[model samples]
Target: MTDLESADRLTEARVALAEAMALHEQGDLVAAERRYRAALAQDYRPADVLPLLAGLLGRLSRPEDALHAWDQLLAIEPDHAVALHEKGLTLHWLDRTEEAIASLERACALDPDNATALGNLGVVLADAHRNLEALRTFRRALALQPDNLHLRHQVRRLGSGAVPFWHIPMMNDAPRNDAFEAAIKAAIGVAGPEARVLDIGAGSGLLSLMAARAGARKVVACEMEPMIAEMAQQIVAQNGYAARITVHAKPSTELAVGAELDAPADILVSEILSSDLLTEKVLDTFEDAHRRLLAPDALVIPRAASAMGCLVASENLAGYAFVGDVSGFDLSAFTAFAPQRLPIHGTMTGWQRLSGDVELVRLDLTQKKHDATLARLSVPVTASGRAIGIVQWMHIDLWDGVTFDNHPDGYHDGGWLQVLHSFPEPIDVVAGEVLDIAAGHDRITLILWPLPRAAD
Candidate 1:
């Protein structure tokens, strides 16, 4: 090409670049994008032009176009931190999570000291439900900018989101801890010091630590929640049981015989029971452990758990289960939507028992499998009142002679709360009468229904 023609092309490209910058500053995004593209077509310093074009595209609400612009810039300057970071943001906006994470991760790696890039990476990780990785990324950003309130908030939010609120209170419950420790000690005693133990749902690493303290040589524990699992590992290390306990941040179902465990565990200790017993999938967890993680004759802590309760009649308790007559209106139909089971602080909640304590259902944890069960229970009435529901608590039979019951009368301020399994509707009965009720579990839930007098 002639020198004059080349010079004229260079002048035209510089003018396009200058016009694009001016249009971008004036908020004329469409015109700015046109000018930026014109400059790029003329090959006028693309490394600089691409970012401005991409930023303009993002401002114009064209995330896909912005991503293409960023990609073009990345193809030219692969290590361009700004291009990588903005590409990550655009990908996230487009709901392409995995790619966004990869882009943001690259940005952070290229610019290790960039707090904004690190924070953005954390946000993408969190959006993808990789909360543990997000928490770690936030912590890294926090380390760089120690006084960043947003980063601190992200850390706290992720940590809380990963762990349940009841965990701390459950940990502080001395009675529950003692019962579990007694069970762990007994299992270790029976299996000897060399016993291999597996603890599922290792909250705070307490159960595994108990096993370690009981002289179990190899204790493997798994917690599904990553934050809680990490905390458990820290607690285990803090309590000097790190050498004995190996905590995996995974569910027991994900654990394998040759990987997480050297061999089948001699004892299986898990406390994943919810207030109502089945909500946490305790049966499924135990069944999986028995099938894949434990020996055929492994000693299972809480070998049996029984749902114990008595018929209850309480004005305060009834208010929670059923409602009616609001502002002289019959809101009784709304009662159909009332909670089937209400959690009640047994000692603090005022209630009267219409019948003596009766065992509603008992779960044998040692069994390899369980089917849904329903049985007829006839409760002999001792007092007369409107029976709102059966206020029930758990009676757990741990290792030989180690049993714990959160009985509504005496057990209070513990991890377990007595659950009021409400009836389909209120029933009135006289003293010295038998109220036949269908009581059992459908594997995943407790089945409690009041039967008709004729059926009884």
Candidate 2:
């Protein structure tokens, strides 16, 4: 072809490209797509034209066509950050999280300072529940733009998450705190404050401080929770007990005998017992501490604990424990798997004892073997009402005769919520008859089984 013919072809392509842009500006999308494609057919800057056309196709709800356009562009510029980021966002929208994270990560590596890419990476990481890493990335972004309101909100959001309702009630429990404090003082008094004291599960560093106040020369405290440990360290310093207390923010399981505990401790004080008893792995922690960390006959602060409970019924709590019907579906069958041990706010929620607080289960934490045992307990009914089941709770023995308990009768608030050991069904009874029931614990939980009543 002559030069004139080539010039004519070039002129036609440029005119078509201009028409596409004009049509796109005028809201004639179909016409714009047609003109754009016609120009592309004549080879008019395919790299620039393709991305715009693909985006328009996407906006027009034609993902399949848009995918083809993007695929072609990616084939040419494999590491193009824009293409990778957009494609990853599209994949994420499609719920293809695995591929989306990979693509977005690649885009981020290619363009490190890309705020959009970093922000998207943080979002996808959060969606995948990688909270720690997501937190780190968010912090990085905030450092880049400290005044960003959205990032600040995200920081606040995660910080306020998991606001446990039981925490406040537990914190304000005066009786529980008093009991623990007394136990700590008793321990320090017995072992002598000059003894190498090891306080495991240093909650708020309260016990450790008590030891320091009692004049302990060296106090080594380990907190299983990082946040709590940090707070405890602060409290220890604030109270002038920092010289005596060295708080390790880690589980007792992770603490090395000779490393974390400088020397074999003469006293091991820990408050890791769950309301029911063994759920906190107190047995495991104590066994390890006793076996490796403590010297022979080291006074275990909570030398022993007994989970004491009684048989009772409450109309108010029955609703939470059993559901006969929900959304027109018979959910009574769910009662079969209903929690044997239910946590109730004894200090807060409305619940009345149907029977006197009977000793249903007694766990002697001092016993060497804590397998499982059942005993016939004849509980005298103090108040006459329908007995549903045994509502079990704890009576802790910190030292010889030194104790703390949230006895359902009076103890209220502090970290622990009362455990309700719901029975299979309700039993009608009156005052003055001995309600025979199996009451005791397997060290981990309180057992309450109904038995034939003994004639009073």
Candidate 3:
């Protein structure tokens, strides 16, 4: 073709591109997309035109079309950050999570300073239940835009979402902390300043710090949650205990004698007991530590833990434990699926003792082995009322006389809440009657059930 003919074609393409921009500015998405596509067909600056077209299609809720446009742009400029970011978003909208994460990750890598891309990547990772990765990504974005409240909120949200909600309150429990510290200090004092101290589930490195403050020269802490573990390391450094403490982001089962620890720990300090006692796999963790991570004569903090509670009647708690008639319908059968145990703030929840507090089960943490056991418990009723279940709490036997219990009577605002071990159904009892109960531990949880009363 002659120069004049080529020039005319180029002029027509430029006009189409200009019209597309004008239409896009005016919110004429359909018209804008047509002109944009027309410019691309004429081979007029396809790189710039494709992104505009794709974004417009996405606005029109045409993800498939938008994906195709993004693909076309990527083919021209494979490392285009904007194209990759938008494509990742489109893929996420299409429910292709893995692909979306890959694209968003590439975009973030290519444009390291793009906080929006990093935030979007975090969102995709979170949706995939990869919370640790999501948290790390948000942290990176927050570092880049330190004052961004959204990024800060995302960081806190993901960090908290990855761990339990009780951690903060648990940290604030001064009595619990004091008990553990006393035990740790006593254990360290007995083991000597150079003793190797190991803390399993070292939340916020609090106990390890306590051990360090108590003159423990060497402390190895393990926390399974990576985010918490990272923070623990930071806290250790912040408190100038980094030289004395090393935090590993691993479960106790994964720790080795010479790897995470120089030798079997001379003092084992772990606080993994759940509200009901063993739901946090304290038995498995302690057993594993005994088998692989501790010295044969290691001083174990909280040498024993007991599940304790009393037979109780509570009109307020019964609502949480049972279901019967609801809005003119017999919904009592639904009670079969009610929560076996309900956690309640001891002093806040209204309840009256039907019987004195009884030791439901006791675990000798220093013992090397634990087997699941269920036995008969005959609870003598002291009050005439309908007993719903046992109001269970914990009594932790730390070093020497260092003990802590969240008894419903006086314990308040502690990390540990009292748990109500609801019976299958409410049992009516007399003041002098003996209520038979089957109470035990299935390794990881407390098992409390009302046995059928013998013919009275």
The residue-by-residue lDDT of candidate 3 on 310-400, one tens digit each, is 9999899999989998999999999999999898864438988999879999999999999999999999999999999999999999977
lDDT of 2 by residue, 75-165 (tens): 8899988888877777777677888788888998898877667778778877876655566667777877788887777666653442346
TM-score of each: 0.88, 0.74, 0.95
lDDT of 1 by residue, 191-280 (tens): 999989999999789889888988888999999898889989999999988899999999999999999999999999999988888889
Residue 271 Cα positional deviation in candidate 3, in Å, after optimal superposition = 0.4
Clashing pairs in 1: none
Superposed Cα deviation of residue 43, candidate 1 (Å): 3.2
Q: What is the total number of backbone clashes in candidate 3?
A: 0
Per-candidate RMSD vs. true structure? 3.1, 5.0, 1.9
Off-target runs (Cα >4 Å) in candidate 2 are 1-119, 144-150, 160-163, 172-175, 185-250, 258-265, 323-334, 346-348, 364-369, 400-402, 442-444, 452-456
TM-score, predicted candidate 3 vs. hidden true structure: 0.95
- Evaluated with TM-score, which candidate comes out highest? 3
Error of 1 at 305 (Å): 1.2
State the number of backbone clashes in model 2: 6
